[model samples]
Target: MWQQSQAGWQTDTGAGSVMQHRLRGLSGKLLWLTMAFVMLAEVLIFVPSVASMRLRWLEDRLNTAAAAGVVIDGLQPAELPRAVQDDTLMATGTKAIALRKDGTSRLLAADHMPPQVDAKYDLSDVPAFQSIGDALYTLLFGGDRMLRVYGPIGDSDMIIELVMEEKGLRQAMLAYAQSVFSVSLMISLITASLIYIAINRMMIRPMRRLTHSMQVFAENPEDPARILPPAPGNDEIALAGRHLALMQEQLQKTLKQQRNLADLGLAVSKINHDMRNILASAQLMSDRLVDVDDPMVKGFAPKLVRTIDRAVGYTSEVLAYGQASEAEPKRRRFRLAELCQEVRDILAIAPDSGIDFVDSVAADIEVDADSEQLFRVVHNICRNAVQALANHRLDDPGALRRITLSAQRIGSVVAIAIDDTGPGLAPKARENLFTAFRGSARSGGIGLGLAIARELVLAHGGTIALVEKPGPGTLFRIEIPDRPVALGDWRVRA
Candidate 1:
């Protein structure tokens, strides 16, 4: 007997290993689709196995009846001749019989049928046939016993049939199918578990360690805390960890350098205060030199006076630089062209150093700025250019030592460009050009001139930048907003 239960076809309700593996790593939709495909495959294999079992049962019944000397008449089975009856019964195993003319059935020997055979196996209404003048027939049907073979006998007009049950074949197929499904499910669970554990250990744990290290470093940069564990082999993760360690070390070095600069600034601030007072006294003494009458005194006295004036100005700037505080700009309208010429005259590199300072400023150009602060900005940039040219001229006396200062109106702003014939800034210097002491040329004294120049220009709501030229030398540009000013309003008090 076959037992039917809905439980055999029930879907899995609990999340099994496959489902858990997918939840941890694979996409949910793909996992579900794969499971559905697995179930469909199982059904396809099981259904075919069941159908084949039933087909084999039918074949067995037909072969048995032929061997037992039974005769078939349409859908009925009949007794065989006594000569072949024993052999036929042994081969067929079961039998049924039916009348040929009217297609009716009568049981010739009930003992010949398989046990548990039901009415579902009956085939009395099927067509009849004649074989070897025997008026034979055979009807084949499938039910719980899986197959029925029926026919009629020729001589006695008796009917016969043979039945073969599929229960054993069905049970065997079901057991094999269950074994296959269990093995597949177990493999999926094991694979998923291994993948989950491997990912958590190798990837997730390392990432967590890196994150923790970064958090600790952010709180205290100087703390010697390890963020990355050293891997034994050379891999991408190991390379990244080494790089991170190097960056941390470099950052610590930079911080120490900055601290040293701060301490130097503090010591210089005190010395600068005292130096300013000494320069003030020198300025007063130089004022007395202007009154000397000798030709030698007259010739060199003015130079001495100018030198002292520049020293006093430099002292004031040094004190300001060390204090790290900016004085508010005393902004007023001024003729930009006049300031350019003043810087050119002060540098005085013409006949002496073979360096030419040329100005190309338009007559009507005016700008809003603090006269003294703007003067410092222009003076520092121009002095640097002059010094660079002088250094280059010393190397090659025939080299053109030219410094060109030009100013022009650009929309609502004025742009001033000072170009010099000197070796252009090195690649390393150019990169850190504006970062306090970081961008200084190795040959120059600390590189504060350009730095202070940029600071003073920025204080006036203007901008200064280093421009690269195709050939040799450097070009520095300063841009300031253009504002209209009355001619008299542009005067500076002595």
Candidate 2:
């Protein structure tokens, strides 16, 4: 059941990943947006074009009627034969035509009694927006009612008016609108295609290539062939691709180094197991050597036992790596000053050794920690400081060598500081400080001291860092936070 549930969860996660990639794609979205903008521009032009066409159609009728009025009014009467009048009205597409000059109206020509004009429109002084609206109204709601239109004749006081059926005008408007729409449709397609092609060529294709390279690289990062080949341009897309390629190359190199370290760690674990056995037997032998009836053996026996014990501790720490986690600290309240004194005694600094281990931690201060593990932490650090001071003393015996330990509690955590007046750490050592097997300050050192110390500190919910300062010594700070108390449970008990 557990395996089946795990498989189902994996399948769901894979489907989510695929859907995310599809929704994040940019090419299809850009194409649709381009087409939409082009259609919007065409609609803007179409509205005004319809208004202008309607105005022109009305003006033609009025002008034709005015010209025929001149011919008729010069005759014996303002009238023509029925056939001629019918022909004139047919050409103008109006039932009657009239002219107003000097505030007097004259009927120019008529086929019969014209119907009452249902709507009045004066095109002389109207805004463009109003014209477009009126044109749309006629095209949509206009029926067979007569429409009265009047406008001035080119800077003259003579105004021409036409009484015309709206059905014919509405039909003509529908045809004109159809043609405009067809042309606008073609224009929108052409504009959208050009924009889409330009952007896809310059942006989308290059971005797609970069995305594909990233997907392939994520699947198998060790393959150098998966890196993106940057597109041929100086644009943003090209630059992004180039940067991605560089980052992937660096990442691959780092991953390869980590793999080598993994293999080395495995070998070290096996060797550490065998060495622990040898050291255990040696420790037992040293335990029995104190019984020998030799004076030197009696004196050196204790030192030999201490050395073997330290060796055992070192091997145990190394073998602990397979657990993938630090051992849980045995927490108990102990005096901080006493712990520092123990570290001092472990280093066995003599009066003439020129190195001083000052336990400046306040006697009143206490710490909740694993005493043995915490002792190992401070011992490793002070031992390294002693070694450095000893090396410096070989050249300059009078140089001051001091390792001072201090601590203070702030809020919920205690900060312990270790300062050494020996030569400061070199740049190379500082770069990888606290990294196992690589942070050694001196030659022939395995560099595990600081690393093991850091692991122990971290197990106590603490942090270790190199404190930068303007002085001729190195400083390391460790901050250990107290475990959170269950305030709610305490209140309930209270």
| Candidate achieving the largest lDDT | 2
Clashing pairs in 2: none
Candidate 1 lDDT over residue span 1-494, tens digit each: 12234443333434366556556653443344455666666655645444444345544554455433333333244444554444444455544422323355444333344555543332333222222111111112222443455544434544455544544434544565577678657655555456556665666556555666777778888766643445554766656667777887778777776787788788887888888899899889888877888788887677678767877776666746645656778888789887777677677776987878878888798878887778778888888777777666356667777888888887878888989878878898898887676777447567677777778888877899988788688888999875555677677531
RMSD (Å) of each candidate, 1 decimal:
13.5, 8.8
List, residue by residue over 417-453, the lDDT tens digit for candidate 2: 9899878888989998988767996667867788888
Off by over 4 Å in 1: 1-174, 189-330, 341-356, 359-364, 393-395, 441-452, 455-463, 468-471, 483-494
Candidate models: Cα lDDT each: 0.64, 0.82
Each prediction's TM-score versus the true structure: 0.53, 0.74
